[model samples]
Target chain A: MSKVMVVTSGKGGVGKTTSCASLGAALAQAGRNVVVVDFDVGLRNLDLVMGAERRVVFDLVNVVQGDAKLPQALIRDKRIDTLSLLPASQTRDKDALTEEGVGRVIDELREKFDWIVCDSPAGIDKGATLAMRFADLAVVVANPEVSSVRDSDRIIGLLDSKTRRAESGEAMEKHLLLTRLDAARAARGEMMKVEDVLEVLAIPLLGTVAESPDVLTASNLGCPITLHSPTSPAARAYTAAARKLLGETVTVTPAREKRGFMSLLFGKKAVLQ
Target chain B: MSILNFFSRNRSAPVARERLQLLLAHERTLAGKSDLVALLQREVLGVIARHIAIDPDKVIVKLDETGHVSTLEIDIEVPEGALARG
Candidate 1:
């Protein structure tokens, strides 16, 4: 059966766009037909991140509104044969996305692709709720912080009520993607610790991404980190996260210096002399 | 609370969790205490008016984030004889 996973968070700038690009690329690299759908309408950032911005002629709204056919809206990646992108409309109002319209497109995608991944916009507004509506699974993107965790908790509540499985009162398969993690700062008591976020969210941890400028470099160049800097720590974490999504028994590498909560406090590496 | 406190408390160990703590809440409040100031104003005035008629416009509840610790201030301009009745 095909899986439709929505990459969502109650907050933005948490690397949902980055994760969508990397996981889509990873699955395609593994030879599965995967299409990453950008549901962040008007902003429409996924295309630029995927390096397909200049190539988009039609978008999800076009397919839904019948302005263009599905194939016309789909853009294949030049680097990866198996990965594709269903870009969002830059000019279309977010209101253009109707429940029935999105349902039609999602149904079409599920039949043709092994995985249909939706990248949800931030907040608990209509945009976010719609993105997760058809999702069989959800990747809740959260930064290791209190506000993001609280927002994620709100989203978890929404997921339990706003989704197809949720309407039927079935549990929505959800996982947490903690990004921008800085081990050094975390050691110095400057950031939220991973275990803390996990406890509050209460969802299974998919993986953790260490803070890396490589993510910025890739997004700037319109490439997924997995494709832009595949060897970086962040990209490797994403790959591992993807494997975990596939139900593979994998061990997530713990961040350095995070051996114990109190032990991390004094290990601060004062800048190199 | 600070980002460090956010992580420390959540991890059940006082580890620094600054990235998410500072960044996320900063994003949520969008402008920090400036936003909370508005929310606190409504609640504080509503509660205080039970005994006195203080000008709601002049009442200010704010978080002073200077110093190593964060402090909250509720400055009220009670209409001269407003507090005399209490």
Candidate 2:
């Protein structure tokens, strides 16, 4: 059976798109059929993250509006055979995602893919709600900041109240993917520790992606970090997170601090913005 | 001393954590107040009111989340001796 997982954060710039791409790529590399759907509408970033931007001819809006078929709009990842991308329309508004249309598309996708990872837009709006309406589980992407944690808490409440599973009296499994963690800063009390965030949000920890220049470099190179720099701390953390998502018994830990020698060599601080 | 401890004394993280806890509790209570209030009133408060002379409308249900456990408080006012009779 296909599992629909929504990678969402109520706040923007918290790495929701990055998590979707990395997890989707990681799962595909592990031989799972995964499709990462971009629901950011006007500001589509998942395609850019997955390096499938140039190949996107028809997008989610086109498929939903009946202008194109599902297979025609799906972009198969060139590097990962089992991975695909359903890019959102940069030209269309969030209103283009109709409830019935999204339902039909998700139902059709459930038949063909083992995982449907929906990348939701920021804030609790039609786009975000529509992205999460049919989810079987949620990966709430959060940063180690107050605003991000608070916003993710709001998203968690929505996952409990606004989802189809919630309405149908089914439990919506939610895990917190804490991103942009700076271990040195966290140790210095400059950033909220993973335990503090888990306490505040009260959600199960998925994985922690440390503050790393590898993320920026990978984004600039238009590849998932796990594929671009497989040995990097961020990549390893994401892979572990993917394993945990598959019910593997992997011990969860905060991302390692790699700022001293690595920063001196790279000459750029891997700080969260 | 390790240079990593340079910012150890900064108070921003604790401040942010405190504010986030307060805000999350307030937000959760606000979102769940109505439905939870109705349900509790119909089931719990009704039974309590039967044994005591109490005001159902004034019952307060505040959800305070500390760490992983959320504490729910139901404050209902009852006249003196109302509980003593039952």
Chain B, per-candidate TM-score = 0.56, 0.53
Predicted model with the maximum DockQ: 2
Query: Which segments of candidate 1 are over 4 A away from where they belong?
Result: A255-265, A268-273, B1-86
Q: For candidate 2, what is the TM-score?
A: 0.80
lDDT of 1 by residue, B1-76 (tens): 4557645543422433334455444444333345577888999999988888878788987676544777788898
How does residue B25 of candidate 2 score in lDDT? Answer: 73
Interface RMSD of 2: 3.4
- What docking grade does candidate 1 earn? incorrect
| Local accuracy of candidate 2 as per-residue lDDT tens digits, A128-230 | 9999999999999999998888889889999999999999999999998988887766655678888889889888888888878999999999899989999
